[model samples]
Target chain A: MQSSIKQWQDWIGGIAAQGKFVGTNRLGFEGKTLKPNQVISDGPYAEVKEMVGGYLLVKADGIDDAMKLAEACPILQIGGHVEVRNVIPMSR
Target chain B: MNEKTLIQQLFKSEYRKIVSVLCKLFGAHHIETAEDIANDTFLLASETWGVKGLPENPTAWLYTVAKNKTKDYFKRRHIFSGKIVSELKYSQLNSESFEMDLSEENSKDSQLKMIFVLCNPLNPTESQIALALRILCGFGIDEIAVAFLTNKETINKRLFRAKEKMRMANIEMELPNSSEIHSRLETVLSTLYLLFNEGYHSSSQHSPLRKELCLEAMRLNYFLIENEATNQPMVNALMALMCFHASRFEARINAFGQAILYDEQDRTLWDEELIAKGNYFLIESAKGNEISKYHIEASIAYWHCTATAHNGKWEHILQLYNQLLQIEYSPITALNRTYALSKVQGNERAIEEAMKLQLNENHFYHCLLGKLHSEQNPKKAMECYEKALILATSSSDKRTIQNHLKKLR
Candidate 1:
C-alpha cells in the first residue's frame, strides 16, 4: 500500500512537472456535519458513500478532458473514485 | 529545427509579449482571458504549422492569429463595442477596425511595464521574483522551482498569492512615473540579478545549470539600457556583472554535471566576445558619481574575466571585495574575500580572517577553511572537509567536498 501511494505521488508529480497542476487539499476526518439551527456534529459519518477525501484541481479544457485526467488518478485502484466539478468564476 | 521545436521556441520568446500587450489592451482583471487567447494562438500554430510547413515570419503569424481571435471574441460577446470601446482610444473605436499593434517599441514598452508591475511593493520578495519569471521571462513552474532550489508547491503558492494580490489591487499594466522609477528600478534590477545567479549557480542535478535563464536576464537588462529613465549607472554595472559571469559558463560545468571551481576552469573555454561586452559595460558604468555594490561586484567579475594570474589581479580583486564588503556586508561576500586575501596576504592571515567570520554553519565557509588548511594542517583540513560534506545538501556540492576529502586521503 505504501509503495502504491508512492507511485500515485510520482504520477501526480509527473503532471505537476508539465505545469498543468493547479493545487490539491487534504480533508480532515472530523469534518462538521451541520443541520438547521444549532444542530452540528462530527457525523458526515464514514458510513455514507458521499464522503470526500480531497480534491485535485488542474487546468483542463472541458468536462471530458478533466475526466480523462482523473482517469489517471490512483484513487480508483484503492476502491476510491473521483468527482470532477466545474468552478463557475464570479464576475470581477 | 522541427516544426514543433520552432513553434515551442516562438511560444517561449513571444508568449509573454503577446500576453502583456493583451493585458494592457484589456484591463488587468481580464489577464486570464488574455492568457487563454494567447495559449489558443500557440495551440493553433502547433496544429497548423506542421501541415503548412512553417511560415516565413512565425512571430508575425502568431500576432495575426491572436488579433483575429480577439476581434472574433469581441464580435461574439458584444462586449467590445460597449466595454473595450470606452477603455481604448475613441479614434481606434470609431474606425470599426481595431488593430492590436505589436510593433517593436510597443512590445518593449509592454515588457518594461510588466517588469515594474511584477516587482510591485505589494508583493513579497519571493513572489515578485516568481511573478517576473512567469510573466516576463515565460518560465514554467517546474523551471522556476528548479531555479530557486525549491519544490513546485512553494513556487505555485507564491505565484497564486501574487496574482491574487494583483487582482485585488488592480495593478495597472503601465509604466510608473519618473518620480517612482528609481525605487522601482532597484527592485527590478535585483530580481533580474537573482534570476541570473540562479542560472549561473543552479542546484538542479538534472540540468545542473541554466544558461537560458542567465541570457534572459541579460536580455531584459538590455531593455533597461535602451530606455532613458532606466539607463542608470547601476543598471550598466549589473549588465557588466552578468556578462562577466556568463562569459565563463562554458568552463564552469563538466560533462558529468560537476561544478568546476573557478581556478581550475579552462580559460580558453571562456567567451571572448562576452568578456569584451562586459568590459564595455564596466567602462560605461563609470559615467555617474554613484558607486553601487553592483559596480564593485562588476569590477571583481571583470578582474576574473581576465582569466589570467596577472601581477596585480589578486590585489585588484581584494580591493574590490573590500569595497563591496563596506557597502553590503554579506557573509557570502566575506567568504569570497578570504580567498582573495589568501592570494594577496598569505594563507595563514586568510585563515585567521575566515575563522573570525561567524559563518561556521555555512558549508562554503568550511570548504574554504578546508582549502586553507590543506598544506599546513592536514588533520584540520580533513575535519573541515568532513563538516562541509555533511552540511552540503545538493549532490554536486557534496561531490565537490567529497573530492577534497579524497585528495587528503
Candidate 2:
C-alpha cells in the first residue's frame, strides 16, 4: 500500500512540476448540514458511502482537460471516483 | 514531517530572504510587487507539495519558482523591455541575473541593505519599526498589530504610508555612507532593542509567543553583527544586552503565566548557554574605546547573572547604573538606579531620591516605593502598595501587588 501511494505521489508531482496545481483544501469532519426542516446538524453525514476527503485546484484549459487531470487520482484505486466542476470567478 | 508543516516552516525562514532579493532587483518602489511574487511562490509550494510530497531541494525549488514568477511579472507588466530595462540600465533582467543576484552572498547583502532602507532616518520611528517587523521579519499584519497594541487596519495603513514614502523618495536599498553610518547604526540598534523588549514584555496572552518575538529580534541583531562592515562596538553591546536578557526568559514567568520578580525567579531555570553567549558578546563589545548605554546596561546584567549572592554585588550594579544614567536618562532607569542605591546607601536616601523623580503616575514607581518603605514603615508601605495596585494595568502585576498586600496583612 505504501509503495503504491509512493507511485501515486510521483504522478501528482509530475503534474505539480508542470505548474498546473494551484491549491488544495482538506474537507474536515466538522461542518454544517442543512435539512428541509430548516434544521442544521454536524455533517458530511457518516451514512454516505463515499465522502470528499479533500479537493485539489488544478489549472486546465477546459472541463475535459480538468477531468483528464483528475483521471489518475489515487482515489480511483480504492474504488472511489472524482467529481470535477468548473470554477467561476465573480466579477469585481 | 508533513508536507504542509514543511512548507510553512520554509515560508517562515525563506520568505524575507526571497523578498529581500526581489526588492533589491525591483527597487523599493516595487516592494509590493516583490512581496506578491514571493507570496505566490510559497502558495504554489503549498498547493503542489500538499498532494505530491516534499521536494529533495526545497529551498532551491522555491528560489527557482520565485525567480520564474518574478520574471513572469516583469513580462506581464511589459516593463522588462521598457521601464525596468532602462531604469536599471546597464543590468538587464534575466534568469541568470536573477539566479546570480539571489545567490547566498547576494541574499545576505540584500537583507542587510533592506535593513538600512527600512531604518531610513527620514521615516517616522513607528513606521520604520513597523516595516522592519513586516518586511525584514516576515511578520503578518495581524502579528504586527498585536506587537504595536493596535488594530490590523492601523498597521496596514502605517505600512502603506511607509512604503509610499519609500516610493516617493525612491529610496535606495544600500548601506548609508561613512558619515551617516554612526547615526544610521544607532537607529538600527534602538529599533532592535524595541523589538526585543516587545518580545520580552509581549502583550500577548500566550507566554511562549512573546519569547518567539524576542528570539526574532535577537536573530536580526545577530545578522548585523555577523557582517564585517556593520559589526561595531555598539551593535555588539546591544547584542550582549539582548542575550543577557534572553537568558532569563524562561525564569521570567511561572507555570501559571504570572510575572516572576527577579529575586524570586529560579536561577536554575536561567539558560546558561545564552548567558555564555552574552558573555562572549560582552567581551567582543569591549574591543573599541566607545562605550554605549548598551555597554553599561549589559555590564549590569552580566553582574546580575554571575553574582550568586547579594553581597558586594549591588555596588557594581550601582556603579554601572550611575554611568548609564550619566549617558542616558530614562525615568525607568532612574527608578532602577534608585532601587540599586537602596542596596548600598540604605532605604532613607533611596526614598528621598525616588520621591524627587516625576514617575508618580507609574505603577512601577509606586511599587518601588512600596519596596523601599516596606523595611522601614509598614503604614507607608501599605499606602504605596495600594496606590500601585490602583495604577497597575496588567492583571499579573496587580496580582503581584495584591500578594505583597496580603503578606503585609
Candidate 3:
C-alpha cells in the first residue's frame, strides 16, 4: 500500500514537473451510495466486481498526449490498465 | 545424461561446492568473490559443454577451470604485489594456493560451516534465508525473486543489505564453538524448517517452484545430517517431517490445483518410498535422548502417512499434539490439533478447544469450526463456512469453503 502511494506521488509529481498535472483523488474503500427513493447503500462498485481505484486529472494538448501519461501509470505494472479520456467542460 | 541436463546438474551441485571452497580459502568477507568465480565457471562450462559435449570428468574439468580463475583473480587484484607481498616470496609461491580441492569431505565441511555462518543470530531471519539461497543453494537473484514472489530489485536490495550485515559482524565461515553450538544449530534448523514450510504451506502449493523450494531445504538439511558434528537427532527428525509431508505432495493437490482433504485424497497417490525413508530417519532420530518439537511433529506426520482415517491414527496424532503443545505452543498448532481431536474424541470436545483458540482472523479456524458443527447444527456449520469463505483470500481456499457450504445447504 505504501509503495503504491509512493508510486502515485512520483507519477503525479512527474506530470507536475512537466506542467501537465491538474489534480487527482485516491478514492477510498469507504463511502455511501444514495439510490432512487432515498434508499442508502454502499458506494459505487459495491455489487460490481470491477472498481475504479482512483482518478487522475491532467492537461494535455490532445488525446495522444493524455494517452502517453496513462501509459506511464504504475497501475499497468500489476496487470491493471488505464483509460484516457478528454473531459468536456460545461458552459454556464 | 544429455549435455544440457549435465550442465544443469553441475550447476546445481558443483556451483555451491566451488563457491564454498573459494569462500573458505579466501575467507567469508570475499563471498561475492567466491560467488563470482563460481558463476563464471558455470557460464563457461555451459558454453564449452554445449559445443564440445560432456567432458570425461565434468567436475574435475570445472575444478581445474575454477583454480585457474582463482589464480587469475589474485593476479588481477594485484594481491601478490600488494597485501601479501612480504609473506609471499618468489620461491614460496606455488599452484597449491590456487588448488580447488572440492573433495566430498572438504566441500561438505565448507558447506556445513557456511550454513552456520549464514545463520548467524545477529542477522535477521529473512536475510539469513536469502543469503543461504544465494550462497548455499546456488539460486540466481531472479529465481530467488520468483521464489519470494517479489521483484528483482527488492531481492537485490535485500541480498545487498544482508551481505553488508554479515560483513559488519565479521562472522567466520566455520562451525560455532561448543559453548554456542546448540543455539546456533537451532537457528540453522529453524531457518531450514521455515524454508521448507514457505514452499509446503504456500497457497500456491501446486507450483513447481514451491516444490523446488522444498527440495532445496531438504538438500541443505541433508548436508547437516551427513556431517558428524551437526547430525543430531533433531536434524533427522526434521528431515523425516519433510519427507512425510512431501510424500503426500501428489495426493494433497488435485489436477485442478485444489487441495484434497486427508481422508478424501487417493491413498494410492501417497509415495511408499518416501514413507519408508521417513521411517528410517524416525528410527535414526530415536537414538538420542532429546525429544525436540521436530520429533513430535515427525511422529504426527508419520501417522498421517501410514494409516487412513481411523481412531488408532488420530489417537496417536492427538497424543503427539498434546506433547507438541507442551514443548512449543503455537496457535496454528493448537488449531491443527483440533481436527485430530474432533476425530478421536468427538466434535463437541474439539469444538470446546476450537472456541478457546478464538482465532477470529484465521480462515482455517472457521473451516475447522464448520467441520465440527456440520453433523449437529447444519445452519451453524453453514454460517461457519460462509465466514471461512469471507475470510479466505485464496481462490482455492474459497472454492473449498464454498463446497462445504453447498453440502450443508
Candidate 4:
C-alpha cells in the first residue's frame, strides 16, 4: 500500500524530461484558520483527515491538455487526485 | 478486538477455522484450493469492512461467505458426484441441489481433527512443525522461515514434501480410531509441546515473530481440550505447563529485551490470572492416574509460581523434576533438573550430577556450573563463565553470562 519515493521520483523525472515542468511547493503547516468572525486557529486545516501531499505546477497547452497531463501523474495511480487550476498571468 | 486490529486478529483466527472446515470437505489433496477460498474470503472482508465497517457478528459473516464460496465451488466444478466422492467431473446439472454444513459444531470438530491431520506421524518432525505453523497458526511461509531461521525455498520444499506424504498416506481430516487415539494424540501433543518450546527458547529471542508463536501453540492445544476424544489427562497437563510459563513471560523479559532470571524477576509482574488458570488445569490433569512428564513438569512450574520461604518449594520442584526425568529422559530436561537440584541439595552434589552429563559443548551447561560455584569458588566460576561466554550463541545469553562474570569478579 505504500507508494515509494523512487516511484514519485521516476514519474516526476519523466515529466521534467518532457519539458513540461512548472513548479512545486510543499504546504507549510505553520498557518492559521480564520473562522466566520475572524477567529483564527494556529494549525493546518483541521477538518481534513486525508492528508494533502502539497502541489505541483506543470506547463500545458490548454485546460484539457493540462487535464491530460494531470491524469498521467503518479498520484492518480495510488488513489490520489490532481486538481488542474489555471495560473492566470498578471500582465502589467 | 478494536477497529484497528479487528481485521488482522479475525484473519488469524477465522482463516484457520474456514480452512480447516474446507480441508475436511474438499479433501487434503485440494488443500491449496481450500486455502485460496479462505484467502479470497479475507480479501473480500478487508475490502468490504474497510468501506462499511465490521458487521455486528463478523465471524458469522465470514462463515456465511465461506459457505457461499464453497457452494459456488461445488457448482462451478462438480467436485463430488453421487458415484465417486472426489471426481471433479463437470456437468450441466443446474437442478442438482447442494447443501453445506458450516455450523460452529462442525467447525470445532474439523479444527480439532485438523491438528492431528497436519501432524501426521508419517511426516518428519520438521515437516510437521512447518505444516502445523502454516495451516493451524495461519503463519505465512516467510514467517515460518523466520521462525525456523531458514529461507523460504527450504520451507516451501518441506511443505511440498509433507503434503506429498499426506497424499500418499491417504489421510483424512478426522479423529483417529480408539485403538490409534493414544499414540496419535501423543504425536499431536508432542508437536504442540515442541512448538511451544520453540517460542519460549528460540535462538533469536528478539525476532518478534515468535512473540505470538507460543500463544498460537497454546491455542491449538486448547482445541484438543475442547474435544471429547482428544481431551486426555496429558493435554491438560501440557496446557497447565504452558499457562504457568506464559504467566511469567512478561517478567522474564526486561525493558532492554534482556532475560531476567527466575530469582531476579519482580514478583509483582507475575500474572495472577494465568497462575489461577494453571492451577485449574493442573487440578483437571490430576483427575486421571496417568502421570505424564507434562504433569510432573507442571507440578514443578506450580511450585515455582507459588513458592514461599518455608514451603519446601525447591524440594518439591526437585522431586517433580526427578519424576519427570523418570517418565521421559532427555538431556535438556535432565540439565534443567540440575538447576532445581542446586536449589534443593546445595551446590556440590548438583555440580557432580551436572558434570556427569558431560554437556561440554552446551553453553547452558557451563553457565549452570558457573552459577553453582559463584559463591564458594570464584576461580571455578570464572573458568566456567569463560567457557560459557565462548560457547554461547545468542547475544542475550552472552549478556547474561557477562553479568554473572561481572559479579564473580
**TM-score pick, better of 2 and 4:** 2
In model 4, the clashing pairs are none
Fnat, 2 decimals, each candidate? 0.00, 0.00, 0.00, 0.00
Q: Give the per-residue lDDT of model 3 (tens digit) for B109-174.
A: 888888888877777887788888877787778888877777889989988888788778776777
Return the TM-score for each candidate structure.
0.76, 0.79, 0.77, 0.75
Residue B181 in candidate 3 has what lDDT?
Answer: 81
Residues B25-130, candidate 1: write the lDDT tens digits: 7766566677778888989999898888899988889999999888877788898888777776444663257778788888887777777878888887778878
| Candidate with the larger TM-score of 1 and 3 | 3
- The RMSD of every model to the true structure, in order and in angstroms, is 21.3, 29.9, 20.0, 29.3
> Comparing chain B with the reference, what is the TM-score for each candidate?
0.92, 0.96, 0.93, 0.91
Error of 1 at A38 (Å): 79
On the 0 to 100 scale, the lDDT of residue B106 in model 1 is 83
Which DockQ-derived CAPRI band holds candidate 1? incorrect
Flag clash pairs in model 1. none
CAPRI class assigned to model 2: incorrect
Writing each residue's lDDT as its tens digit, candidate 4 over A1-92 gives 23354345434433343345566666776777789988887776677777677887777778886786576577788798888888888995
Supply candidate 4's per-residue lDDT for B25: 66
Local accuracy by lDDT, each model? 0.81, 0.81, 0.80, 0.79
Worst 10-residue lDDT window for candidate 4 chain B reads: B86-95
